[model samples]
Target: MNKIIEIVSSLDTNQVYAELSHPNSGGICVFFGAVREFTNNEQVTGLEFETYEAMALKEMNKLADTALEKWGLNKVVIKHAIGKKEVQEPVVVVGASSAHRSACFEACRFLIDTLKETIPIWKKEIFKNKSVWVSAHP
Candidate 1:
């Protein structure tokens, strides 16, 4: 397959390079979304992610297909981690490989942005005393 779409409990960057590498591609672009230490000046202890698994997978597959066709990508990988994650832990990873740098660069951005806007995944920010479920967009 030209694409890999999955919702995982953990994200492994080591596998990303192999997954996005293609002989026809000159460049691969990757974006890793991680749990940050702070949000809105509040210290974030960690994060919890939840998703409608069936729908999230469907949307992710659609994104990979669209990116492949639109950018002529040789390979695509989209993954998101569920459950709890500590600060600095990767929450999601998206990548694309194309014949040149431009296509992969733009496709990588599109894949992540569109996924955040449309996918059924939700995130909760954990603080010292309380937790808040955050919207997909700010």
Candidate 2:
């Protein structure tokens, strides 16, 4: 079975790992995208992520389904956090399981790459002296 998708204020790596664990799954690929302290040397302080939740969720699920079909994977889980996030905090996590390592890795990478390009989300960057809005997937 597929795992849940949560949009929360925070995420725990261990908890996410445990949720994706499966007895028949021989390989698991995990990806964590954290809030960076600097973007183009702008000295970022924090970021606020906003999404059209319904549309974003639909796209994310479509990404997972495509990956599963292409890779013949056992399961896939994608979780993203919204709202204000501090530097170094995880913003997104993706996990994929398969019977082999190659498929797992490929699917995981595809999931994240596609998500960053296709998801409809926006991020407001708060810098030390200025702030700006940018494409979340960019």
Models 1 onward score TM values of 0.97, 0.91
- Model 2 ranges off by over 4 Å: 136-138
Mind giving the per-residue lDDT tens digits that candidate 1 earns over 1-138? 899998999998899989998999999999999989989999999999999999999999988999999999999999999999999999999999999999999999999899989999999999999998996469
Clashing residue pairs, backbone N/CA/C < 3 A, model 1: none
Model 2, CA-based lDDT: 0.85
> Using alpha carbons, what is the TM-score of model 1?
0.97
Candidate 2 lDDT over 16-78, as tens digits, reads 667767787789999999989989977999988988999998888888888889998878888
How far residue 105's Cα lies from its native spot in candidate 1, in Å, is 0.4
Top-scoring candidate (TM-score): 1
